[model samples]
Target: MEVQLEQNEKKGKAFIDKDGKTLAEMTFSMAGTKQLIIDHTEVSDELRGMGAGRQLLQKIVDMAREESLKIIPLCPYAKSVFDKDDSIQDVLRQ
Candidate 1:
Protein backbone atom coordinates (compact mmCIF):
# COMPACT_ATOMS: atom_id res chain seq x y z
CA MET A 1 0.00 0.00 0.00
CA GLU A 2 1.22 3.49 -0.78
CA VAL A 3 1.03 6.25 1.80
CA GLN A 4 0.23 9.83 0.79
CA LEU A 5 0.97 13.05 2.63
CA GLU A 6 -0.59 16.51 2.59
CA GLN A 7 0.38 19.50 4.66
CA ASN A 8 -0.04 23.25 4.87
CA GLU A 9 1.40 25.89 7.11
CA LYS A 10 -0.34 24.72 10.25
CA LYS A 11 -1.50 21.11 9.86
CA GLY A 12 -0.92 17.95 7.88
CA LYS A 13 -1.84 14.33 7.37
CA ALA A 14 -0.35 11.11 6.11
CA PHE A 15 -2.90 8.69 4.74
CA ILE A 16 -3.84 5.91 2.41
CA ASP A 17 -6.63 6.10 -0.14
CA LYS A 18 -8.38 3.27 -1.86
CA ASP A 19 -11.04 3.67 -4.54
CA GLY A 20 -11.80 7.21 -3.45
CA LYS A 21 -12.02 6.32 0.22
CA THR A 22 -9.49 6.75 2.98
CA LEU A 23 -8.29 3.53 4.57
CA ALA A 24 -5.92 5.00 7.13
CA GLU A 25 -4.83 8.42 8.31
CA MET A 26 -2.60 10.15 10.82
CA THR A 27 -3.18 13.86 11.43
CA PHE A 28 -0.84 16.43 12.89
CA SER A 29 -0.33 20.15 13.29
CA MET A 30 2.83 22.17 12.94
CA ALA A 31 4.17 24.00 15.97
CA GLY A 32 6.45 26.74 14.76
CA THR A 33 9.19 25.36 12.54
CA LYS A 34 10.53 22.55 14.67
CA GLN A 35 7.65 20.55 16.08
CA LEU A 36 4.88 18.42 14.65
CA ILE A 37 2.01 17.69 16.99
CA ILE A 38 0.32 14.40 16.20
CA ASP A 39 -3.32 14.67 17.14
CA HIS A 40 -5.17 11.69 15.69
CA THR A 41 -4.88 8.35 13.92
CA GLU A 42 -7.42 5.97 12.44
CA VAL A 43 -7.66 2.99 10.15
CA SER A 44 -10.61 1.45 8.40
CA ASP A 45 -11.68 -2.07 9.29
CA GLU A 46 -10.25 -3.39 6.05
CA LEU A 47 -6.84 -2.03 6.97
CA ARG A 48 -6.99 -2.79 10.68
CA GLY A 49 -4.36 -5.25 11.94
CA MET A 50 -2.50 -4.78 8.69
CA GLY A 51 -0.11 -2.09 9.93
CA ALA A 52 -1.81 0.66 7.94
CA GLY A 53 -1.65 3.09 10.84
CA ARG A 54 2.01 2.45 11.29
CA GLN A 55 2.62 3.05 7.60
CA LEU A 56 0.95 6.44 7.77
CA LEU A 57 2.92 7.37 10.86
CA GLN A 58 6.08 6.25 9.18
CA LYS A 59 5.49 8.71 6.37
CA ILE A 60 5.23 11.50 8.90
CA VAL A 61 8.33 10.29 10.70
CA ASP A 62 10.23 10.26 7.43
CA MET A 63 9.20 13.81 6.70
CA ALA A 64 10.21 14.90 10.19
CA ARG A 65 13.65 13.51 9.63
CA GLU A 66 14.10 15.18 6.26
CA GLU A 67 12.87 18.52 7.58
CA SER A 68 14.69 18.47 10.88
CA LEU A 69 11.52 18.60 12.91
CA LYS A 70 10.51 16.99 16.18
CA ILE A 71 7.35 14.96 16.72
CA ILE A 72 5.16 15.39 19.78
CA PRO A 73 2.83 12.44 19.71
CA LEU A 74 -0.34 13.59 21.45
CA CYS A 75 -2.52 10.91 19.89
CA PRO A 76 -2.64 7.71 21.89
CA TYR A 77 -1.68 5.40 19.07
CA ALA A 78 1.17 7.60 17.99
CA LYS A 79 2.36 8.08 21.55
CA SER A 80 2.34 4.35 22.12
CA VAL A 81 4.37 3.72 18.99
CA PHE A 82 6.92 6.36 19.92
CA ASP A 83 7.14 5.03 23.44
CA LYS A 84 7.93 1.56 22.21
CA ASP A 85 10.24 2.31 19.27
CA ASP A 86 13.66 3.34 20.38
CA SER A 87 14.96 3.60 16.85
CA ILE A 88 12.56 6.41 15.91
CA GLN A 89 13.41 8.45 19.00
CA ASP A 90 15.72 10.64 16.95
CA VAL A 91 12.74 12.60 15.69
CA LEU A 92 10.65 12.40 18.86
CA ARG A 93 10.13 15.50 20.92
CA GLN A 94 11.16 14.98 24.51
Candidate 2:
Protein backbone atom coordinates (compact mmCIF):
# COMPACT_ATOMS: atom_id res chain seq x y z
CA MET A 1 0.00 0.00 0.00
CA GLU A 2 1.16 3.48 -0.87
CA VAL A 3 0.18 6.43 1.26
CA GLN A 4 0.33 10.02 0.10
CA LEU A 5 -0.06 13.25 2.02
CA GLU A 6 -0.56 16.77 0.69
CA GLN A 7 -1.41 20.19 1.93
CA ASN A 8 -4.60 21.76 0.65
CA GLU A 9 -4.19 25.40 1.56
CA LYS A 10 -7.59 26.54 0.35
CA LYS A 11 -9.33 24.16 2.68
CA GLY A 12 -6.67 24.40 5.38
CA LYS A 13 -6.42 20.65 5.16
CA ALA A 14 -3.77 17.99 5.18
CA PHE A 15 -4.93 14.89 3.40
CA ILE A 16 -3.57 11.43 3.98
CA ASP A 17 -4.44 8.67 1.58
CA LYS A 18 -3.56 5.11 0.72
CA ASP A 19 -3.92 4.05 -2.90
CA GLY A 20 -6.22 7.01 -3.63
CA LYS A 21 -8.65 6.56 -0.75
CA THR A 22 -8.29 9.07 2.03
CA LEU A 23 -7.44 7.52 5.36
CA ALA A 24 -7.16 10.65 7.47
CA GLU A 25 -7.44 14.41 7.35
CA MET A 26 -5.97 17.13 9.50
CA THR A 27 -6.95 20.77 9.58
CA PHE A 28 -4.70 23.55 10.86
CA SER A 29 -4.08 27.24 10.89
CA MET A 30 -0.92 29.29 11.04
CA ALA A 31 -0.49 30.83 14.49
CA GLY A 32 2.54 32.95 13.68
CA THR A 33 5.85 32.93 11.93
CA LYS A 34 6.85 29.68 13.49
CA GLN A 35 3.75 28.25 15.05
CA LEU A 36 0.89 26.20 13.71
CA ILE A 37 -2.40 25.45 15.37
CA ILE A 38 -3.75 22.11 14.39
CA ASP A 39 -7.53 22.32 14.61
CA HIS A 40 -8.37 18.65 14.25
CA THR A 41 -7.25 15.22 13.13
CA GLU A 42 -9.72 12.67 11.93
CA VAL A 43 -8.97 9.18 10.80
CA SER A 44 -11.43 6.99 8.94
CA ASP A 45 -13.42 4.77 11.28
CA GLU A 46 -12.14 1.67 9.59
CA LEU A 47 -8.58 2.96 9.73
CA ARG A 48 -8.58 3.77 13.42
CA GLY A 49 -5.88 2.16 15.57
CA MET A 50 -3.95 1.46 12.42
CA GLY A 51 -1.08 3.87 13.05
CA ALA A 52 -2.27 6.31 10.39
CA GLY A 53 -2.28 9.09 12.93
CA ARG A 54 1.33 8.42 13.76
CA GLN A 55 2.25 8.53 10.12
CA LEU A 56 0.43 11.81 9.60
CA LEU A 57 2.02 13.35 12.68
CA GLN A 58 5.48 12.28 11.67
CA LYS A 59 4.90 13.90 8.31
CA ILE A 60 3.81 17.12 9.99
CA VAL A 61 6.88 17.05 12.23
CA ASP A 62 9.13 16.48 9.26
CA MET A 63 7.57 19.44 7.46
CA ALA A 64 8.03 21.65 10.49
CA ARG A 65 11.68 20.62 10.87
CA GLU A 66 12.39 21.23 7.22
CA GLU A 67 10.92 24.71 7.46
CA SER A 68 12.69 25.48 10.72
CA LEU A 69 9.41 26.13 12.48
CA LYS A 70 8.12 25.49 15.98
CA ILE A 71 4.87 23.70 16.57
CA ILE A 72 2.09 24.69 18.94
CA PRO A 73 -0.31 21.81 18.94
CA LEU A 74 -3.78 23.17 19.66
CA CYS A 75 -5.58 19.93 18.97
CA PRO A 76 -5.79 17.59 21.92
CA TYR A 77 -4.96 14.54 19.89
CA ALA A 78 -1.86 16.19 18.47
CA LYS A 79 -0.78 17.36 21.89
CA SER A 80 -1.18 13.88 23.27
CA VAL A 81 0.85 12.35 20.51
CA PHE A 82 3.73 14.73 21.01
CA ASP A 83 3.59 14.80 24.77
CA LYS A 84 5.49 11.52 25.04
CA ASP A 85 7.52 11.95 21.89
CA ASP A 86 10.88 13.15 23.14
CA SER A 87 12.36 13.27 19.67
CA ILE A 88 10.21 16.26 18.77
CA GLN A 89 10.57 18.13 22.03
CA ASP A 90 13.37 20.20 20.55
CA VAL A 91 11.10 21.77 17.98
CA LEU A 92 8.20 22.44 20.29
CA ARG A 93 7.54 25.98 21.46
CA GLN A 94 8.39 26.39 25.10
Candidate 3:
Protein backbone atom coordinates (compact mmCIF):
# COMPACT_ATOMS: atom_id res chain seq x y z
CA MET A 1 0.00 0.00 0.00
CA GLU A 2 0.95 3.59 -0.62
CA VAL A 3 0.08 6.64 1.39
CA GLN A 4 -0.49 9.93 -0.39
CA LEU A 5 -0.60 13.27 1.35
CA GLU A 6 -2.29 16.45 0.20
CA GLN A 7 -2.31 19.72 2.03
CA ASN A 8 -2.27 23.47 1.70
CA GLU A 9 -2.04 26.11 4.44
CA LYS A 10 -5.37 25.45 6.11
CA LYS A 11 -6.05 21.75 5.87
CA GLY A 12 -4.55 18.41 5.02
CA LYS A 13 -5.26 14.75 4.43
CA ALA A 14 -3.36 11.48 4.46
CA PHE A 15 -4.76 8.84 2.20
CA ILE A 16 -3.75 5.21 1.75
CA ASP A 17 -4.79 2.55 -0.68
CA LYS A 18 -3.85 -0.30 -2.91
CA ASP A 19 -4.81 -0.96 -6.50
CA GLY A 20 -6.65 2.35 -6.84
CA LYS A 21 -9.05 1.73 -3.98
CA THR A 22 -8.99 3.82 -0.83
CA LEU A 23 -8.01 1.93 2.30
CA ALA A 24 -7.97 4.65 4.90
CA GLU A 25 -7.74 8.39 5.39
CA MET A 26 -7.04 10.91 8.08
CA THR A 27 -8.02 14.56 7.78
CA PHE A 28 -7.19 17.68 9.71
CA SER A 29 -7.53 21.43 9.62
CA MET A 30 -5.21 24.12 10.79
CA ALA A 31 -5.83 25.72 14.13
CA GLY A 32 -4.46 29.22 14.38
CA THR A 33 -0.84 29.50 13.24
CA LYS A 34 0.93 26.52 14.73
CA GLN A 35 -1.55 23.81 15.49
CA LEU A 36 -3.61 21.26 13.61
CA ILE A 37 -6.93 19.76 14.69
CA ILE A 38 -7.34 16.19 13.59
CA ASP A 39 -11.05 15.85 13.01
CA HIS A 40 -11.71 12.64 11.16
CA THR A 41 -10.26 9.22 10.40
CA GLU A 42 -11.77 6.35 8.51
CA VAL A 43 -10.63 2.90 7.47
CA SER A 44 -12.39 0.90 4.86
CA ASP A 45 -13.78 -2.48 5.91
CA GLU A 46 -11.59 -4.17 3.39
CA LEU A 47 -8.58 -2.64 5.06
CA ARG A 48 -9.52 -3.41 8.63
CA GLY A 49 -6.85 -5.11 10.72
CA MET A 50 -4.22 -3.91 8.26
CA GLY A 51 -2.99 -0.94 10.30
CA ALA A 52 -3.93 1.49 7.57
CA GLY A 53 -5.53 3.85 10.06
CA ARG A 54 -2.37 3.93 12.12
CA GLN A 55 -0.35 4.57 8.98
CA LEU A 56 -2.51 7.54 8.11
CA LEU A 57 -2.15 9.02 11.56
CA GLN A 58 1.58 8.46 11.50
CA LYS A 59 1.78 10.37 8.24
CA ILE A 60 -0.02 13.26 9.86
CA VAL A 61 2.32 13.14 12.82
CA ASP A 62 5.31 13.12 10.52
CA MET A 63 4.04 16.17 8.71
CA ALA A 64 3.43 18.02 11.95
CA ARG A 65 6.97 17.36 13.07
CA GLU A 66 8.37 18.50 9.74
CA GLU A 67 6.35 21.72 9.84
CA SER A 68 7.04 22.46 13.51
CA LEU A 69 3.38 22.32 14.39
CA LYS A 70 1.39 20.77 17.21
CA ILE A 71 -1.62 18.52 16.94
CA ILE A 72 -4.93 18.49 18.76
CA PRO A 73 -6.45 15.12 18.15
CA LEU A 74 -10.15 15.82 18.00
CA CYS A 75 -10.85 12.60 16.21
CA PRO A 76 -11.31 9.74 18.65
CA TYR A 77 -9.06 7.37 16.79
CA ALA A 78 -6.33 9.94 16.61
CA LYS A 79 -6.80 10.87 20.25
CA SER A 80 -6.43 7.26 21.31
CA VAL A 81 -3.31 6.83 19.26
CA PHE A 82 -1.81 10.00 20.64
CA ASP A 83 -2.73 9.04 24.16
CA LYS A 84 -0.90 5.77 23.89
CA ASP A 85 2.22 6.97 22.15
CA ASP A 86 4.48 8.95 24.43
CA SER A 87 7.07 9.42 21.71
CA ILE A 88 4.73 11.63 19.72
CA GLN A 89 4.25 14.04 22.60
CA ASP A 90 6.73 16.43 21.06
CA VAL A 91 4.09 17.56 18.60
CA LEU A 92 0.95 16.86 20.58
CA ARG A 93 -1.16 19.77 21.78
CA GLN A 94 -1.55 19.81 25.51
Q: Compare the candidates by TM-score and give the number of the best one.
A: 1
lDDT of 3 by residue, 1-94 (tens): 6789999988889998678777789999999989999999999998889888888988888988998999999999999998998988999988
Task: Give the Å shift of residue 78 in candidate 2.
Answer: 0.5
RMSD of 3: 1.1
Instruction: State which candidate has the highest lDDT.
Output: 1
Q: What TM-score goes with each of the models?
A: 0.98, 0.81, 0.93
Clashing pairs in 3: none
**Full ranking by lDDT:** 1, 3, 2
Can you write out model 2's per-residue Cα lDDT over 53-93, one digit (the tens) per residue? 77777777777789787777888888998898899887777
Clashing pairs in 2: none
Who is ahead in TM-score, 2 or 3? 3
Each prediction's RMSD to truth: 0.5, 2.3, 1.1
lDDT of 3: 0.91
Residue-wise C-alpha lDDT for candidate 1, range 8-53, written one tens digit per residue = 9999999999999998999999999999899999999999999998
Candidate 1, overall lDDT? 0.95
TM-score of 1: 0.98
